[model samples]
Target: MQGGVMRRRLRRRFGLGCLLVGIALVVAQSAAAEPRRLEVELSQLFDRLDSGFSNWQGQRLEFQSARPGDPTWYGAATHDRRYGVEDEGVSLGAAVPLGADWVLQPEAGHTFDADFLPRWYADLRLQRRLSHGLVGALSLRRTEYQASRVDRLALGMERYWGPWRAGYTLNVSDVSTAGTPVGHALALDHYYGERSVIGLRASLGREEEGLPGGEAITSEVTAVALRGRHWWHPEWALSWELGTLSQGDLYDRHGVQLGIRHAF
Candidate 1:
């Protein structure tokens, strides 16, 4: 990863991990409690950042507590070192019901002594359950760097039918220096026994790039991944991903991530 693209790739990795967790939890049956309102998860990822910059890696710990059909509080703390610079960040957020089958999620985060990652970040999303197992959502995100800013908007749809879920999303991003670029993502997941799931996701899109010397450009990027989760015990679950990404001809990379989640 190089310069600005590094942040974008990092964001994608985190997003992919969260995606698997979210989808899995939606169908998970804890067997400990009716809802298992309180939960904690620990995860790590290893990536081989090419081009001799540095290897990218991180560990994350997150917690959430909430009851069904009620307001939820969640937070995360992360320690990451990429490009040979170490940074730590924390974020707090909530999921609140807005009536009429609508839901809202808002979060804010800040990185301490940041060099590669954004110094400040915020996101807001609104979603509603539609007819016949369909849901629609819209989201906006902002990331502030030392001397740059990026804003993104996304529209998404998800459908669940007979042990299968499918989703699609379109994202448009605007960089202060680089131009706006659009990306599309699609996913499919199948569930068995309420706690085990397997999924595949693919994304292809254009990304805004600001090179080392204030050179702004747009680049094509594509990624594909297989992710899954299974419950080994009533209160414990395991999740994993294997993925590859390519950005034009700059670099080709493969990575793996694993996580464990528990309810208390």
Candidate 2:
């Protein structure tokens, strides 16, 4: 009887030890299997850029719309007319962790029009975290217009402060006829919540004349946009935006856009 009791006790002790070892192994494996968190977003914008032409100085104003074969000018005698121009663009973007305190994002976008003009853009940015809820980013972007075969490069710095973000971009454009023209842009964006955002962006740029003998023309653009997203499931979402664009002295453009996204 004594020998049997001793054997039973030894068996119980060995069983408990095995269970503990199993639990420890599981905990270690789970820690090793955990994945780092990363965030990515893809967005599209359907908008219009209206160029309101007004008589300023002695220049004969010709207002051209994006629509194909539209009259270049309603009449030189008329000073007030509306030009309706629109563009549809889609962007694919991804953000990933590079290391501690650093992140990198790369994005590409393409725009198509009914008039056989297409635009393509590529951007790469690197961000570093700073103290006091601040972050800084350095970005490089390239844009190409397929119809005209013109290309532009932009270098910029972005700053984040609390819920507000701002950036300045410098652009150098190469035209087939005019050597190169430099432009500058400044933009501001504000976030109201985790999923709601508003942005006010403006850019002042110059474009060389399409014709051989035309001189460089200055262009200015201002835009205000509001965007929001709602998650229906863990991997699915709906997003929407409303925005307005003003180009030079031509016209004001208003647009609304919606999209649905799913993640695998």
lDDT per residue for candidate 1 within 1-264, as digits (tens), equals 000000012333433333322332343223334453576778787777566556668777777676545556777788876656677888887767676477687878887866666787898878777777787879899877766777989999888777787889899999886679898988887776645677788888986543332233557878898987676786687867788877666666677878787868
Candidate 1: lDDT of 200?
Answer: 88
Task: Give a tens-digit lDDT track for model 2, residues 1-264.
Answer: 000000000100010000111111111122333332222233333334334332111111111111111111111111111123333444454444454455565656555541222365576656665554445556675555543444566665556556565667677777654567776666565655332344544555664322111222334545555544455665565655565655456455565545454433
Candidate 2 minimal-lDDT segment of 10 residues: 1-10
User: Which stretches of model 1 miss by more than 4 angstroms?
Assistant: 1-36, 208-218
List lDDT for all candidates, in order.
Answer: 0.66, 0.39
Number of the top lDDT candidate:
1
**What is the clash count of model 1?**
0
Number of the top TM-score candidate: 1
TM-score versus the correct structure, for each prediction: 0.83, 0.49
Scanning candidate 1 in windows of ten residues, the lowest lDDT window is 1-10
